[model samples]
Target: MKRSSRNYAEGESPRERIVNAARRLFGSKGFYATTTAELAEEASVSVGQIYRLFTDKDDVILAIVEENVRVRLAEMHSIFDAVERRELAMFEAIKAIAANSLHNEDGSLFYEILAEACRNPTVAERFEKQTAFYRDGIRRLAALARPDVPAAELEAYGDVMMACFIGLGHRTAMSPPVDPEATSHSTACLMMRALGLAELESGRVQTQP
Candidate 1:
């Protein structure tokens, strides 16, 4: 693995370095193809250092998955807070989310991890847990948007919304390039309608003509 010119902080620990290296290598070369020696070389640490910090490569992958999940959950909380406080409109938030989901580098990493989860039981377990956490956050956001909707129905909406986001990610990764702005606008409109926010759709039409 080739090292980027960017310097790691002086205080950055070997464990952190190894996990970061694993994220890049795993995302690029894939979990199965990437070897322990490559990971050690990329991190500028000895193979022994990796074993001291993690049981094996899978442990390192899990650590990266956990970190990614934590950061994304925090972002979701921020989005929920903004919407709850009326600092951000629900449609606008959805648009921003769709755009990020399609364009962000981490989006590719997320899909890579999902593929790994299919074969690795440990990764699959952690992935499923993080997915549940993500779904719960979406459910809460839906409840905030539709206070009158029953919890059961809101949960269903969350499931469908997550499916839409995942499908959008795959679509964006396909060969024919996708227009981010158009995709965001259409997804936001679809989600708003699904959430029973007809007023937003009406506002959009009223502004159009």
Candidate 2:
């Protein structure tokens, strides 16, 4: 199973340890710069163990991406649940999701993955698989949106959300911190308005759908 976090405790499985180490090392160093030997050393596992658990460095990166997508989907589901329970407004949920997209360093990892994928066929294939996995997650989220839109409409929402969220990651990495909350709010409003879940009042977006 993919880990929800990178924390490793006593008696953690070798595969889990290896994945966690790879996540950290890959985050700190470019994918091309990190070698299997370094991964083995950081994971506290033998090179043999690394190979036994994963096909190669590409496989390790795939595992990391899969885990990241799983966590994001779970968080999105929880936010939706909160909205259903009336504990969170739909606008608030969108803001939460957008803020999360802006807060992470996934953009750097994304570019690093692209660079590695260009040089290695296996990495390219793995990247494609992980992207499909994330795309499916987005489709599920779109299906769950309020007012029960048609399949084509849901697909459009998912497409817009995915593209904008990925763009936000790049924006976060490139831009200086300038009222992140304001940026997140506007982005959230855009998504909600597009989804037909927002109504404007007093020149401000209402939390309700």
Candidate 3:
């Protein structure tokens, strides 16, 4: 993971500290239970400091959600860029997609906020925008993968991919620790079926774990 260049100076930005602390704490405790006071303590600042940086707990959560979306979108775009550049084989690309969804730092937080957004309006807006971004990214990639498909149908295909991705994310979010690679391979196979692509005759997908 790349560290931010922001120095731990005499007067470091409160917002940066709060965001970093929130990312770390929320990754561990989740959104519903992680309190503002706890976040303040984690940030090494007072609760009022948190308020100064953000309007309220929801605002802080929104900032976290936005940051999470920014990172995940960038990561997905990178993988898609490799696909666009023909730098990765189809199977290798699918693996990269799977690895990114489950293994990336912000992915967990993305899903956490998404789940919470079910009840919270502020979070829901961010979640909706995040969904749109992924849908757009997927549509672009699906078009690149199969140019013969109509644009409208390709858009639906993109939606299907997003659905599969979300399902994979939720499976990982559940307890008992689901296997990301297996889930991803299964999803890729299903996508192949949907696209009428040739599946492996051996019905084999290499498992990473």
Best prediction by TM-score: 1
Give candidate 1's TM-score. Answer: 0.84
lDDT of candidate 3 over 71-145, digit per residue (tens) = 767877887787667675555566667656666455567667767788888768866786677677777667765
The segments of candidate 1 whose C-alpha lies over 4 angstroms from its true place after superposition are 1-6, 199-209
Work out candidate 2's RMSD over C-alphas: 5.2
Candidate 3 ranges beyond 4 A from true positions: 1-13, 24-32, 104-112, 199-209
Order of quality (TM-score): 1, 2, 3
* Backbone clashes in model 3, listed as residue pairs: none
- Model 3: how far residue 70 lies from native, Å: 1.6
TM-score of each: 0.84, 0.77, 0.75
Local distance difference test scores for all models:
0.75, 0.75, 0.69
TM-score of 2: 0.77
Residue lDDT tens for model 1, 34-149 = 98898888888888888999998777877887886677678778887987777877787777767766765555566777777888898899888877887787677677766776
**Candidate 1, residue 169: how far the Cα is off, in Å:** 3.4
